[model samples]
Target: MFWALFLLPAWAVAGSACLRLCLAAVRAAATAPEAAGDDRALTLYEAAFLSGGPRRVADLTLVSMARQRRLLLAHTGWATVVDPRGRDEMERSVIGAIGPGGQSRIAPVRAAAAGTEAVRGLADRLVGAGLAVQDGAGSIAAGVRRVRLAALAVCALAALALALPVPSDLPDRLVALWFALPLALTLGSLLIARMEVHPYSRWASPAGQRLLTALTRRPGAPADDPAQLTAVALLGVHAVGEPDLRAAFAHRERYLEEPAAPGH
Candidate 1:
């Protein structure tokens, strides 16, 4: 039937996306490194990097600055540098992003912070130390997105099939049932992926997440140290006890909604 022509491409694309995502998830899980022993404890910055990738590292840096009274984040999303001198490269990069005027938007500051050599240094260390996966966290996240897109494609295909006129010999109900097959496949793949990937869904690898879990389980861990607290903030802003600091990093939705700043 002529409808077959339209349905074929949709089926192919949805099927392929589903298959690729499923395989990638399985391969990642099967090949992931086992957790390291507690002796190989992660540094605060390293924990930030592992738990939330470069942006989290940038967030940790920003929180650290605020805690040190070197920077201020306003509720309206402006960042002000109270002190210009940066004790380290990461701080320096944030200061540079604030420009010479000692003022800039928080979004731009985050962008610059993530691109700094300091962030890259942390990433290199994590990868080299084998706490982070070699393929990178982005790849895993991308796979999840691909599966989601495939599910949408399947839904579109089902709608199309329902809208098109079918042959007199073919039952309309049968066409709906037929299209449901690929729809089910795509949805099922997505469900499986979410379940399998959720455990290590953040920036951390299986090993890194395991270490993070253990680290958090300790009594008063990361509580006495500012740097350690910043790392915990990276995991989630809610973990930061300070109300202002928590609000400062609560821009996660903003960061996700907006495109990355240019040249970042």
Candidate 2:
């Protein structure tokens, strides 16, 4: 029973590799644009995009409401903040998830302001970072496959050792602890390998959520997410023809077009 524990570190290493691979698989497999599900990072982009508005009384009121929710979520500090030290630190810090299950949003002053270049820059950076993460997921998936094969070999060796006839004088406690720990850790690692966060689901909600909408949309998917294509389509439009990310600066056009009132 304890044979698995001695290999705990190796199992954890293998597990993290598999976790990365599984997440990569999800990123690769998720092709349905409309079917994208909710995620903390995607919600951040959405919140930032919506903050740029007509600045009407009603919009301000909505912002106030969102703020109250933010306050409540902050009270517990249970939100999902991505790697603060990552290359995309600006986007991650400016916008993040809050509340239980991290259902709400927080915005950076730059993204929230009207007629600012910062909003567009943020969107471009977010899209770029998101694409990188998705690609990394793919790489990790390949790495996991290799690690699993190696793990099987290790397991076999450990099993053989376990089966070998031993002198009766060996301490039972030592035998149990050595193998049991690694196996338990390995099993736990396997469980963590299955986390799924649907990035495309960012578009499903529309309450001040343009960033989420734009980032998650995969508008041109063929039958069955063919060819594993990836595109960043923030807002209701895809950035495909935007030309060198200059389109990010153009988000002000949409901000200027907002209705005089929120929800109008």
lDDT of candidate 2 over 31-75, digit per residue (tens): 333333334333333333333221211122222222333322122
Clashes of 1: 0
> Model 1, which residues run further than 4 Å from truth?
26-39, 133-138, 166-169, 200-202, 227-232, 246-264
132-179: candidate 1 lDDT, tens digit per residue: 655553446556677678768766876776686666356767766766
Determine which window of 10 residues in candidate 2 has minimal summed lDDT: 53-62
Q: Give the true-structure RMSD of model 2.
A: 17.6
What TM-score does model 1 achieve against the real structure?
A: 0.77
Clashing pairs in 1: none
Q: Each candidate's lDDT (Cα)?
A: 0.68, 0.36
TM-score quality measure for candidate 2: 0.27
lDDT of 2 at 169: 42
Per-candidate clashes come to: 0, 20
